[model samples]
Target: MTDLAGRTALVTGGGSGLGAAIATALHAAGADVVVVGRDEAKLDAVAARLGRRARALTCDVSDPASVEELRSRLADTAVSILVNNAGVPGPVAALTDISVEDWDAVFDVNVRGTFLLCRAFLPAMIERGAGDVINVASVSGKRPLAHRTPYCASKMAVIGLTSTLAFEVGPAGVSVNTLSPGPVEGPRMARNFRLEAERSGGSVAEAEAAFVSRAALGRMVTEEEVGRAVVAMLDMPGLCGADVDLSAGMIA
Candidate 1:
């Protein structure tokens, strides 16, 4: 068991779902956690539940100004763990029909935000010779989805980013890894399923079931499952730069 006692961690998108799960895990491991998200109320609620060790901050990862503000605020704090989990589902459009604006917007959060956050935090970690960065990518990063051109492209870019950063920072005691989860059962997934159901003339239940059936595990991933994996990564020593696929073997 790895102990993060007295360590500081910053988790983006920690207002709910997988982000909350990772924050909780970090707290349980004895780390002081800072949760950031666009929703102040949601961030507050999660931080409150996470106890005194957790603090909440608000920022939109897609906005350069917001990210700059976040960097300023966190400058004085020694953050050793960085989880880049904030992301958009991306505007659904066929590759041939996608707009430049739509593609840029998605890339802004998934790629540019990841880039900025890493750039902002790495100096401190490098100086101290310790840190871990987890980028919450998706199976779509490795495999293409029918109508998710922007998201897929952005995530694929993330895979490359994770690998390259891991190599560059590994010698300095900073570990960077990417996690690509299959479909997870959460409010986000439910909303997506609902939309697909309506658009495809299928019931919501049917749509959800179809998603599960296509997965190698024949089930939707649980928040707890993802939480534990992140926790494990935090615990592992000398581990740097790996694409951990949590797709339940569904990559095929």
Candidate 2:
């Protein structure tokens, strides 16, 4: 658990769900963790669970100004690990049904957010010649997800960024890897099921079943698995420009 001792990690959207889980795992691995999100209360709650070696800050990853402010705030802290976990699921509807605003909103957060955070932090990591950047993309990025064009496209963008950024920063001893998780069980997914059911005139159970069936394991991955995977990837010093799928065999 002390594998990351003496290191500092900054996790965006660390207030809840996968982000919170990742923060906890990093903290457990002995990294000083800074959890950032739009919700102060949720961030505080996650910080509380982390006890020592954890603190909370609020920032909108999609906002350049906010990210710049965050960079200013962490000027004294050398963030060795950056987890771009903040993302929106976007509207669960066909591309034609999804509005321009909805589509842009997804890209702004899922794509632009990752870019802003990297722009704000990568320089220091390159200067120091040591760091890890994990972008939480989704399996939807590689596969076509029905009725979720915006989400799929945005994630693909993140995936592309991870690989290209790794190639750019690897010489500086920085590792940039994409963590693409499959359908995860949580409120977000529950809401997706609700919307999908409403769209297809099917029960929520049916909607869930259809999605889960795509995974070879016939089950969704858990947030903890993802958190641990982040730790695992970080532990591997040679891992760079890699898309590690923790999706329970959702290869189809």
Tens-place lDDT digits, model 1, residues 112-231? 889988988898999999989999999888775777789988998998999999989999989999988888878888887887777688999998887777777788778888888888
Q: Model 2, stretches more than 4 Å misplaced?
A: none
Local distance difference test values of all predictions, in order: 0.87, 0.94
Clashing pairs in 2: none
lDDT tens digits, residue span 1-252, model 2: 439999999999999999999998999999999999999999999999889999999999999999999999999999999999999999988788889999999999999999999999999999998999999999999998899999999999999999899899999999999999998879999999999999999999999999999899999999999999999999888889999998988975
Model 1, stretches more than 4 Å misplaced?
Answer: none
How far residue 113's Cα lies from its native spot in candidate 1, in Å, is 0.9
What TM-score do all the candidates reach, one by one? 0.94, 0.98
Pick out the ten consecutive residues of candidate 2 with the lowest summed lDDT.
1-10
